[model samples]
Target: MTPNTARRNEASRRAVLTAAFDLLQEVDYAKLSIEGIAARAGVGKQTIYRWWPSKGAVLFDAFLMLSEGAGGEPPMLPDTGDLEADLVLVLRATVDELNDPRFEPPMRALSTEIAHDPELAAAYAERLDGPLREAKRQRLRSAQQAGQLAQGLDLEVAVDMIWGPVLNRWLQRTGPLTTEYTDLVVTTALNGLRPRGSSS
Candidate 1:
């Protein structure tokens, strides 16, 4: 495509994703339609259809875009050489995100889609979850190298152990998904991950 056409296509894509997210905040997902999204985005219905296969896909892309929260490179969690502090920062931020009105609706929506749609769940793993998990594990690896964690500890399980409780509470609504809750999770999980005799 020509440069102008490429830019226009990208602009339209951004508009559609943004519109999809905004509409979910205003209306229930059942009321959200491809036609409505197209109208809100100021693009033709075919334009949205050309880019995304379904309403869920548009919403999925929208969720991803917003979760990223910025452009250029994927941002990494702060590595201050203090593993406990870094983990608490990350999990507490997750608490804030799960509590966000702007994000909750789409998060619930995406969770629903993934549960029912295996293909979408697979794509979510590949596109969003995989990269984020890798980054988290990278942080954990750094801690291990610095002797913050047990040398034989499995980072994969460590990642899940650290973040899993927060996700379960958020998804199941079993309890408060608060910073205090996540703070406790980090403290508890880190206690296990820390090397013997290493002060947390």
Candidate 2:
């Protein structure tokens, strides 16, 4: 493609992704449709179809774009040499994300939909959950290598242990998801993982 054509294609793609992201803040996932996205994006419906196979695919891509940090990289958990502090930082960010008005409604909507839709669940896992879990696992492994975590810890299970409670509260709405709650979860999990008698 010519330089101008490539620039135009990139611009069009950005427009669609931005429009979809913005629209989700106004409407639930069930109410979001390809036609609405195209209209909001000021592009032809075919323009979106040529890029994404379905509305869910478009939303998934938009979600990723929204979650990206500076330089278009997915947000990374911080590494501060203190495992507990790092975990708390990451978990607090998660709690804030879950509480964010722009993200919460769509995320909750998608979660409910995924429970009944196996295909959607798989897509969600592939795009979001799987990568996030892997990132957390890698951070835990780093702590183990630093001798901050107990030897022989099952990193995968440890990751689940760290995230499971936060996710449960998020999904069940059984309690307020606050900074204190996240800090408590992180402290509790790390206390168990730390080598015996090691200072937290």
lDDT of 2 at 31: 86
lDDT (tens digit, per residue) of candidate 2 on 14-40: 899888878888887788888999999
Instruction: Give the runs in model 1 whose Cα sits over 4 Å from its true position.
Output: 67-69, 193-200
Per-model TM-score versus the true fold: 0.87, 0.80
After TM-score superposition, what is the CA distance of residue 87 in candidate 1 from its true location, in Å? Answer: 0.9
How many angstroms is residue 70 displaced in model 2 relative to the true structure, after the best TM-score fit?
3.0
Model 1, range 37-115, lDDT digits (tens) per residue? 9999999999988888888899889867766776746658899988888888888888888899998888888888888
Model 1 RMSD in Å is 2.9
Alpha carbon lDDT at 95, candidate 1: 85
Top-lDDT structure, candidate number: 1
TM-score of model number 1: 0.87
